[model samples]
Target: MRAADIDKLVSVGRPTIAPDGAFAVFAASRPDLTANRAVGQLWRVDLPDGTPRRLTRGVSDTAPRLAPDGAAVAFLRADAKGKAQVFVVAAGGGEPVQATDARAGVGSFAWSPDGARLAYTARTPEQGRYGTVEGLEPIAEAPRRITGIRWHANGLGYLADRPAHVFLIDVPSVDAEPFYEPAPAVRPEGEDAPKKQLVAAEAVQLTSGAGSYGGVAFTADGSEILAAVDEIETDRRDLSSRVVALSADGGTEREVLARTALLSVDEIVVASDGTVALQASGVGEGRVDFIAPAVGLYLLEADGPRLLTDPDVLDLGEVGSHITAVGDDFLVQSRSRGTVSLVRVSRDGATASVFDGDVEVAGHAAAGERIVVAYATPDSFGELALVDRGALTDFGAPLRAQGLVLPGEREITGRDGYPIHGWVAVPAGEGPFPVILQIHGGPYASYGIHLFDETQVLVDAGYAVVYCNPRGSAGYGRAHGRSIRQAMGTVDFHDVIDFLEGVVAGDERLDGARVGVMGGSYGGYLTAWTIAHDHRFAGAIVERGFLDPVSFQGTSDIGSFFGDEYVGVDPVQMAAQSPMAVVDRVRTPTLVLHSELDYRCPLEQATRYYAALKRQGTEAEMLVFPGEDHELTRAGQPRHRVQRFDAVLQWWARHLPVTG
Candidate 1:
């Protein structure tokens, strides 16, 4: 498959299974090439056989959560401007009803235990947040004031003055009989979305506080709502979260428990027996990388909160919200090494892997005696399947015929005898094919389990793809992951080279002389570091990556704290770790790609690296994408994502051609 062919793949998330295991629902997203946009919609899958069907085709309908009784499903649909609002529809089939209409729209929601209400989050609309034209248009056109230290985020851009608060939406107990099931929500030619008559929903402001809140849930008896609320009167970026309980009637507000700065509740949910379940974590003394915070299941009862599961491989997957409670034991999603496992955690602190596979699970929902999950293997983007007992069913059948290149696993030891995990994929009949070492973005993220789009595209281009979880990468344990702090390029770089050299030497199908290294974010950091430190790479590609930690402290969002924690508190120490510090030694041909709108790395990082390379007479090319963010690959414009991969393919084909 080619890079553009990535559009053909569909990914599923936010899964929900029916009570009786008859059917399941999930949100499926795919690139709409005709519309030049990525669209999401609700989809249903019949259990046992895993027959899939699409439902509710809104512009961006996502986060499908089924009601407790399985009578209805509620989801959030984004408008043309991408402001989200809640919507609900009957499980049987009917016109989806708009359920909530807050001024700032809705964030995330939880269904009340009795199904009488939904406790959701909504931002209080402020003057500057919206305008007559549309969301933040007036502010973007004329902006002079800069009050907040952290102003812009990558995907969301400028932060609104309003803070998000908890809100409650009444779930109608009656069923809706629509006069007509309308066609898919579509925008007319040269216009916004087609006008529609939607049902008005009653909403009430649940928590009026100056703090940000998320990971909400409703109690079993429907008396209170639980959420991770940070009411600290400080910068929203630095606030530590705590679980808070708010009355369903929006009357009482109480902190459920208090945690030290060392640890806090990442997610909170109430089981059927009124026991509170949460994933408590403390990555370090104070680390900012929330992607793979060292976490374990914790339960709160009359005695107070304590760890229910050991913090070994209990690092929760990316989805922090969906903490499924199956009876007293909670079905937890944990990642060990590079593999994501659906683990069942008991109150007695015992944990067992529900399913065994060399694959990653995106989400799982329990129904009757069965479990439905959205999983992705090394060759499939996503598959919705009925995991009967502990076996994977026919979810990958539809996508399997599309021809995917699956990788084989390999392991290598890094410093201190740390075993670094990696995967290698080679095309058919490979004779020392050109290699592209794929480095995942998050220094804490893994790349081996998922059907990595870039790996597939590169392998199809006749290049052997190599990816690994270096020292800094997660899925191992706490000590191993935190080992990257203050030692960014040194330790992780050794792990990368060790794995690459071992893998290349062991296999005759890998061309070590014609190998290229490419990565983004932290991976990008390592790629640039590798090029400067070692001169063997044929080419390098670094996107939305760090180059200098000195100026990055002032320019980038979360820069000050991140540099302080990750690199060092001193300016000289921070600069010593950046790739710009050793730019004078870089001889490898490098491609520096950064997004103009990427506030995370900031475009100046690209400018610094590119200018240094050019001044030093190094072969380098720079590409800056307009209106894109640090998430230029996965969440950026579909066309741009394709173009970015095309650039990599062309660069590799020119520099390290696979000769016939």
Candidate 2:
């Protein structure tokens, strides 16, 4: 795929199965070149050999939830103010009616058991803040008091002043007419009577106080809503969450269900019998640990909490993974050997694969005996496929027609004889071509079977792309992931070098002498470190790097505990692993790319690295994008993503030019 192919790329997500297993609804999104934004809408497909068809027409619609009674489908759609709110439409067909008018918009929502009401979470901003009162601008708002560690987030800035709270709103009846209230009688004498004002049903706030709530769900009887609450205390350091039970009627205070003190909960699911299932990871010594002991499944029963899945064996996807309770057991998405599959874990920790193969399962939903999954492979983007049968809808067919290069999978032997899984994507030419060693962010993140656009773009530019999941990467077992903890640039660095060398030695179409290394975040750290230790690359691109852990801890969002867990606290020990300490040894031409608004790694990392390289008389350049966070390549603006691709190609052309 070329750089412009990004506009034609399509993916499907957020699949929800009907209660009777008759149909499934999902959301499909594609970039709009004209508007320079992503456009999404709802799509539906009937079960048992039925064609998929468009269900709703919205600019941006996502997070579809099928009602319990199967009479309606509720989803989030952006309003005129660009805030996502809940909208409901009939299961068969009809216009979608807006059910909420929240000022701060909704984060997530779930249908009640009886399908009469919906439970959702939204930020409850202070009355005088966030434009809550008319004529009060954000710039004119009062200054915030310094209190919490998590006061500022990456995309949502200054969150301490407006903590999220649970809310309940009744669904509007499709057959009923629009409700309106008369205007006040005290109008100006010169003007005629004002038109009646349309009034939406008010939503009741369920929880309050200095905390944020998410992942809401109702019990079997729909009496209480279970939500995960994060209370940021100044004394506490670990970012953990507590499960709470709130009355659905807003009649009483929320009751603490489970503390989950030492564990960090990413998602939660409630069973029919009031059992709470959590996908959590252990934070040893109350500090965030890296990559080791992957997130596992835990059950909060009446007696106590019990481990349901083995963390060493199965790594829960956590980001796009879904957990559904089935009787006494649960079905969740787990990553193993670079592939994500749906697994069934019994109450006693007996794990069985429900859907396992070469595909990367992004999301899944099931009801009764019927199951559907949204998956992606090396050639296809995410598609809606049935359990036993193959793909039911081809959402990526248009992009596939534009020609996508499929990566060839390989297994390399590391310096220590450990096996490293990797892939190589070569251009369509016959002669040898320059190679690009691409590294993924999150030293824990892996390069999987998904069709990545970055690799494809390089291949289309007549350059070979190589990527591997060395030690410290996820999707391998816990031992493999934790092998490099506190020893970042030692064995993991050797493993990366070994994998790249092994691929070059075996492949005939790659020119090893002309290679360019590039990566972002943790990958950027490794790229900078790799060029410094071994001057084999002609050029390098370091984007959003964590060059110094000491400075990162003070500025980054997760920096407070991330460096302490991975790099340790000793200044001398941290210096040995940091790239900033050894950047003077670099001789390769480098391009330092960064985002101005990125809070994950912060912009100082790029500036510091670039300045050090330039001061030492080494060739260097820096590129900064405005109004973008750390997720620039993945979810940035469409025009900006294309512009980034153009810039990368220009850098490669100047340093390691690919020739036929």
Candidate 3:
């Protein structure tokens, strides 16, 4: 099997099971290399039969949720412009109704338990000054004339004066009388007729202060609501969240729960017994736990908060393991050996795997006793499978291998004696093929054993693709993951080069002399630094990366705070770690990619890098996306996303031509 062929077998997304447990909804996109630009769409899987059907026809429809009565499914639908709006469609599949009309966009939403009202958070335009404030006073002068609207920073958009507020929409009654009656009068062309005013829907503001609500959930009795807040303080980024009970009529609010430090509540599910089950994470070690009765799963209700299951529950051996809740149960995906399993925790503290095999389950959903799992094997892209309590056999038949061959995977030792795991996809029917070294972003994030589209594309185009998780990558212990701080271009780059050499040594099909490198964000920073420090790479692509830490610290939205964790000391360490400080050594053909609205890294990062390369007489080009932000890869402009992929392919083909 070739890596490109594996695209047909692997699927990645979280599915939502209906309240009745009769059906499940999920998002899937073709992973074919030739169809690399295909957008994701919502698909429905019927229980018992396990037959999957496509529901909405669009570029990408995500975050599917079944209504309380199971009459409709509400999801976020993105159009060609990449603007996502709240849409609802019949549970049985029919015309979709557009619910939101905001220009900024709608992300996470919730349908009230009563089904009469819908509460959602809307993104609004923001305008603010861009500079540092040393003391209590504003250091930069406020813009005299604001030419462009800033959205909510934090990788979303520029910040606006108005914050995202929760808006309540009353479901239009099927037989209620019209709210407005028009005046019946025809006047002459130049004469003005009597004006009639229409009744405007009133929007009730939930939380007032400066913070923005991240997620919302309705109580089982439909009397109160819960939300996560990320507040903006004077000096630091404080994320103090609480689960408050608000009057159904939108009047007063009483705090039922509160936390001191940073907390992320991913999902909340109310059990049949009125007990609230939530998946939450606190500051410090970032351990995910199931919070209930203010205690862990195994402990008695009277016994304070206990750790039901620690990090060792998944038995990932050396690789790290994390669990994500899917309805009543949780789905655990292991990154070490790459296997996914359905685990159920009983009130008695017993844990069992419902279904386990060689296939790596990417996502799962549960509805009472029925469960739906999405999985992909080494030879397959992705396929949907079903499981039930009493069933002894897996519901779906084994899917045929998609004819894609995956490359061999291996672990190499880095300069620090740490195990650096990587995968190498060799071209089919090839000898001495050009190579591409791909690095993942989120210096903290790791590339899992799951299937990827770009890897397949490079292999199909007759190039050996090598992707690795170097030092500072997750799945390792906290100390290993935090070692890259203040050493950006130093240790991290050395580990990547070590992994690349190890891959080429084992695979004779790879051409070491004709290799290229590319990455985004942190990965982009490394790509820029690699070419700047060494001329080994024939070509390079840097996407939405930080060129100069000093300038990035001032321009980025979280500039002040991110410096402490990423660069340690302060802006001084930032300048020393920045690739721009030594750009005169770059000699490779480089392509700089960035988005205009990117507040995470800012467009200036790309501009400075491109300018530096040109001044040094190096082959460099810049591609700026018009209305895109930091999420250009997963949630970028649709047309430009396709263009970006095409540009990468063309650039690689031009620099390193494929040989027979």
**lDDT for every model?**
0.76, 0.84, 0.65
TM of each candidate vs. truth: 0.91, 0.96, 0.78
List candidate 3 stretches off by more than 4 Å: 1-13, 28-41, 56-61, 77-87, 96-105, 124-151, 170-205, 259-262, 285-362, 375-383, 388-403, 570-572
Lowest lDDT 10-residue stretch of candidate 2: 251-260
For model 1, the stretches where C-alpha displacement exceeds 4 angstroms are 132-149, 172-198, 231-239, 259-262, 283-292, 317-321, 389-399, 413-418
Decoy 2 TM-score against native:
0.96
Q: Model 3, 433-550: lDDT tens per residue?
A: 9989998887766665655666766777788888887776655544556677667777788889989998888878888889999999989988988887778888999999977777
lDDT of 3 at 550: 75
Worst 10 residues of 1 by lDDT: 231-240
Against the true structure, candidate 1 reaches a TM-score of: 0.91
lDDT per residue for candidate 1 within 142-195, as digits (tens), equals: 554655556555665555455678888778533654434457766678866544
RMSD of each: 4.7, 2.2, 7.2
Cα misplacement distance, residue 388 of candidate 3 (Å): 6.6
